[model samples]
Target chain A: MLAQGVGIVETIVVLLYLLIVVYLGYLGWRRTKSAADYMIAGRQIHPFVMAMSYGATFISTSAIVGFGGVAGMFGMSLLWLTFLNIFVGIFIAFVFLGGPTRRMGHRLDAHTFPELLGQRYQSKFIQVFSGLVIFVCMPLYAAAVLIGGSEFIATKFGVGYELALLVFSVIIAAYVVMGGMKGVMYSDALQGSIMFVGMIVLLIMTYSKLGGVTAAHQELHAMANVPSLFKGIGFKGWVTMPEFGWGQAKYDLWWIVVSTIVLGVGIGVLAQPQLAVRFMTVKSKRELNRAVLVGGIFILIMTGVAFVVGSLSNLYFYKHETVTGKIVAKTENIGVIAKKKRALEARIPCTLLHIDTNNDGVADVDVVEKGHDVVRDGQVVLPASKLMPAAEVKDLGDGMVEVRPRAVAFLRAVVQTKDGWMFNTDSIIPTYVTQALPGWFGLLFLVTLLSAAMSTLSSQFHAVGTSIGRDVYETVTGKHGHGIGVTRLGIIIGIVIAVLLSSYARGGYFIARATAIFFGLCASAFLPSFFGGLFWRRMTKAGSIASILVGFVITAFWLLFIKDEEARAIGLCFKLFEKHSLLLDKPNWAVVDPLVVALPISIIVAVVVSLMSKPPSEEHLRKCFRGV
Target chain B: MLGIESKGILAVYLLCIASSVLCVVYGLLSWNRGETVPDDVKW
Candidate 1:
């Protein structure tokens, strides 16, 4: 109910954007004649198109909506991810892995990551197993992206969440099922360009509205306070890194800043299947080389702008809003006051009740009286013994304290609620657009968000479908002839599964959290096997299978068991074992992610198991390692 | 000297923009080094 719009001009613009997207899908479908064309765009994509598609797929509403919203709550500490996205995701991924992946995939004639592994090792088992894992686990990720987009639309149009999700899912699914990889990439390129323009404009507007970069951040710095839950880290501490330590308060900050946000996401991007296949879509090493700058700039504009604007939203809210309690009038009747109290409680979202203690000019103290308090005309009374001091009012001694309005609102609207501050974080970006921008631009920005979600979702659906068709069905049935039909069926199935999962993918969760979770899962499951197959001559078939299986199992175990909140969400914690996380009790290292635990285990198991077994045959080694 | 917050904010913008520009320059400079498709790998 923030701001609803169905203006004629905005509606026309949205409809026009959708038409162009559908047309692009049709163009891709027209060009896609064979399985290869459907899967990898016939490996003839231009460098710019490849880079844009890769970047567009890599960044989605996860970065812009979920992470941006989080930035509003967590402050600028999240900017470390921008550095990692460029350096690790774009530079290392394209420069170090891109050329070799393209070469090796070509050498093996591999259409998918599972197919690549299966071919390199000459093992149908490795291919089918990897494909099964992708088919099963990828829906969680796709669902997260779906929710990110649908929620934004729901907020913008005042539609129900279910209806918004269905419409967005069906539209993206139509293009993905029809166009395949070629259509996905083409639409991705268009979307990426749109996102770039939208984000740059957004960042400029955010700064201009707040009076400039320095002024905005300075205001943010002033507004900083460590909420009670964080326990130790103050606002300044949240803004900066904790000095390296395992001590109580410092570890909480490090756990959040480093273990979860930075490393879990940063290092995890190297092995994403959707991103890896992008390298194979283009022709040469030079294409990848050329793509580096384009991808870097695209990501910077997409993610950098999001983080900047997201954090700057705090300044906007501070200047424009105040949290107000209902006005109390002087009266003498206890019965009328009791009735008014109940009405006020029902009316307001805030829990705090303001009472004029001395019947003075200004209403004196704000008390969060849960179930008991006497409100009478002119003055009110609460049991002095039970009242704990409100943190918003700092005691300056002499029975006097200064009250901070923003701080009080923060305490009431965020901390005092059952859900934490991050509960409202996901809505920040959309709310900003609707409330802050002009009407026409808000509609345009909505298009940018839809493009972000659709481009990524299309890529994900295509990747999952191709994995099932090529790696599982084709490998099992030995029918490479009817591959396109099988893949199209797989696309539909993937969309259905993702839609189902998204219905359960809500509740105070940010899209970026789900994104990072999947990235970490992929890195743990695929990195050891993929990197080993590429670089190590002695990496045997048994070793690769063992590594992949172990990595997948460990990542699943950690996410569904050790991460208490995630475990509870999945209905796995109490039913399967205990209700609480195993790591929740371990205060020093509770913030460490499953990827941290799983990746090393996968690598070690792969290396040790490979060396213990017989080396791969000379012919296999020559084909895989030397690309003979 | 500028405040830490100002410097940090500036760095985020500069780093992103600089990295992108450098990439474009490098790509343009090396554009001619790419070989045409080899016969065996031609799609």
Candidate 2:
């Protein structure tokens, strides 16, 4: 259904884009002759390239498709994340952390994030441990990005998932392995530029389609009472924040939206190793300073546009009407009825259908149908099957049969009336794009998503490769000069692992959750130490090590045993505790993100351990903080 | 403001724009301030 109007125009556009991307990778390879060039782009990258590369890598397809879909469900409240993304992700990251990181990295001659930490703390254990965490855990995040990118390609072009995964991985791997950081950043800038233009056009078109900005918001605000399940969990209106309180259902939406979605990503951006590594790629503090301006605008557009467009898409769906009807069966023979049900099931998109089988007042079961739209008489018809067990058929004699009248109900996408089917939130953006936007814009948006995915995957693969080659290999093998070969191998391995994981990982919400898990984990494990390393003179190697281990271990423990979303998905808590979460009995603890608990404890551990242990020698401190 | 009734949501919306403007102002003001060569380049 998504590939309805796609044709030679999309094919040519994608091919042209890929050709240019490969050319940029080749250019990066030509310019790269040394380890520095491969690892950190020789520390001479222009401000625009670094800024665009950083923004593009930071906001992946997860931010657009996954989180944008979330906005469609939750409303404009997600704009808080956009604010944080610009303020903390770009401005503070570039201003506060970027300068010190660049200066210190230069002074230490560090090539990677782990290398910088290892050299600063003068601990090989820190380097190896950090590298191992990245190499092992980063694949989950990379796979999420891979899944998002390849699925779009598969759907847009009608290709197999495996083929799309293979092709996407190979294109990124070729560039990342050959050109390294330079190749990744160069292509990232190009991708970022495309994404910027695409989002701008999307915003303009969306607002225009909805009769301008204020009118669109006003209409969305007025549709607050469109009854759905989200209303029960503290959703007030699209324009307002969810009702804020604690205990049971009172604050479930608030915690899930603010703590998990907003804060988990907002605060977590500072410590993302893949993003933090970009700050060290620039030549001087001036580059980082200049980067903030471009970075802020870039991030604002990327995420801000997505959130705004996502929430407004509901208005589009609400206003547009397809065919709405009640299903009536004509045959009552068991075999004939079964065959008809199967046929209908094979021809409808996966939608949530609410039907009341019993004579009670409440709907009993939710029927999810996964297929294509069933078009009859030039109108899309509601498809029914055994999936809707509540629907009963009766014989009216004379070879005619009919479904019970009570079982029949009208259906619309996402708009749940007393009895209607709802569209999957994940399908909101794609459906809106196909149904609302011009055909040309759909092609542009697809390219935008591809760029978002590729840019992020490149940075992730680069980080994974360098962590192994520069940090782990050098620490383990006690060899320094042969990083390029090992780094290329690491890139291949990383790509393979991501492709494998992408093959298995399914569902829409997984993209956003997997990304959040990685981000929250990184924030807990690395934030305190990273922040202290740059700003604190008293931080010691023991303190940093203790903080890293505590942060990582605590976050892992919470994700496995306490956090409901992850713990239930992992099933470890269920097996061990015989419950979905260890904190299932607790009011709001199960929903509170791991970062909220672990980051504070990590900071405390860093402080206490530093205070208890002897401080670093004056000479080492001076060496680490010379330029800062 | 902007047809969004909630002050909290409006604050967040405004902050996103304000932050970007702040970054521009900060970048322009500090563009040349940190360009000096380090006194000690030796590792």
Candidate 3:
């Protein structure tokens, strides 16, 4: 746990922050008088607030802790994602889509994103289906944020995970359900500001600790020759892109990094319901235009600092010596050696053991021994016969025997450490924060993480509520102008679902994968239809319906059947096909994200279907495109 | 540049900063261009 023994300071700071947040929620609740106010902040939100809300909701703990951890493992190649976030997410979104979306939303008298599309196409089915998709699919994302934040709170404050999850959900639910969009956005502005400041400090501290920016990166680059588990799968170094090639090993990392991490969330931001609805929160296109500046800088700082600091953390870990356990046996008996290995494994916090064979204090090989076989990189490098007499020894041919363990003790080097636990990539930022930075910064960073989580969760809950009240319930029951009660109820239900999912889902990459799943799903399901509705006047109701349905089905199919991470988690592909992914036999297809496949096909379908069907009525088009 | 050896990574790193500058320029240039409210709008 980070910030241990400083619980009093952290508690006071966290309590004060929560009080301010709740007060802002109360202010929003007091101001919200009508459906418009509750739904879209009366469509008169300040440009700064709207932009910050949009950014805060867009970047969650998933971006900082989850994706930051990814940066730690994959290195500065993730800077491409930071670039896309600023260019595509902020510049393109605000400049190209923001004005049109705002105009069309107002002209059509639409409140939510689904309502905009539904009113534009004059199809209640579009609204209801889209609402259902968001309500159903968004919980996974909310859970990711929930888990990320709760984990931090639990560790920082020494609370149980369950208690942290419950408290986190309750606080977010209270605000979102009461204040609605106004509360969500107001709180988001504050949280976003904190995140901005926190990230800046983190970057400055990191560079200073590592000498300077150039020196830090150079040190990371120099450590590229160090033995790493990812080296087999095309990882070259921390400062460079993964080795690019068509071979299976190289192509896998490239696809996962470029397609999934960079492009998936990059393009996916355009169609996020929580984010797009912010365009409608503003009065004029000028606000959206003005927002572009703030949004760009905010996103750049948030993602850029995270990725840079994450990559640089490698230098810190390499230079610092962590607690390690050394095991030796006087006798070279096979049974006695195996028993000693088991005891050593029980003592260590990590599963995959790394041994320093040459006594240089650096780990030479990461080995997973099964019975008498010593495996490295999934191959039996030391056969049972080799392990029989020598107790795991390899002659280096340079007169330096690389002995694992025989008559002498072998030094084992654990990776990074936190509270005596072996640190994985997910723990990199947290470990770095607790160990390297000043204790005061931990309090601020904790608040930053909480703010990130709560801000995003608040918007997600608000989106879910509005989806149910405006799109699903109204469309289904033919009710109009009366949705606040149902919306509040929906927020509660959404919070419960998220809490439940967070409790059940547990893994090393769970947070990152969940975030990517939602982002990729949103891109596949919403991007084509949303883009077509905005720019193309010819896009018809049938085209949108077909695109949404096809995009959704294909993405779902890919997640359940092709993507190894999701498929194995769901266990559906394994149940039916007896494989983690159906494309396990096929090379890179399994790793290829659903967004890459579904989004293009969805776009093509939208174009073909819109062209083939009767174009939208000119009168309707004029009404939708009134101001733009 | 920036102590990064890979040209690809260096380009991306530079582009991130450049794109933010581009956004700032665009936002400043167009700040007062689109403030007109549509007629017959109700609030």
Candidate that scores best on TM-score: 3
Instruction: State every prediction's TM-score relative to the real structure.
Output: 0.84, 0.86, 0.87
Best by DockQ: 3
CAPRI quality level assigned to candidate 3 from its DockQ score: medium
Runs of candidate 1 with Cα error greater than 4 angstroms are: A226-238, A242-244, A247-250, A321-422, A625-628, B1-3, B6-22, B36-43
Ranking by DockQ: 3, 2, 1
Q: What is the DockQ of each candidate?
A: 0.38, 0.62, 0.70
Q: Candidate 2, residues A1-628: lDDT per residue as tens digits? A: 2524458978999999999999999999999999999999988899999999999999898898878878887888999999999998988898889989888888888888888888888999999999989998899999988977876787678678799999999999988888889999999999999999999999999998888988888888887866444666788877899999887766788988898889889999998989988888887788888888888889999999888988887677555322122222221211111111111212234423333333243333332322334458987663334223233335556433333222111112232211223343444566567556878998999999999999999999998998899899978998888988988998899889988888876553667778888899889988888899999989989999999999999999999999877787678878877888888888888889998899999999999999999999999898888768
The order by descending TM-score is: 3, 2, 1
Worst 10 residues of 2 chain A by lDDT: A334-343
Give the C-alpha miss distance for residue A208 in model 2, angstroms. Answer: 0.7
lDDT of each: 0.72, 0.79, 0.79
User: What is the alpha-carbon lDDT of model 1 when measured against the actual structure?
Assistant: 0.72
In model 1, state the lDDT of residue A160. 82
**Top-down lDDT ranking:** 3, 2, 1
Error of 3 at A196 (Å): 0.7
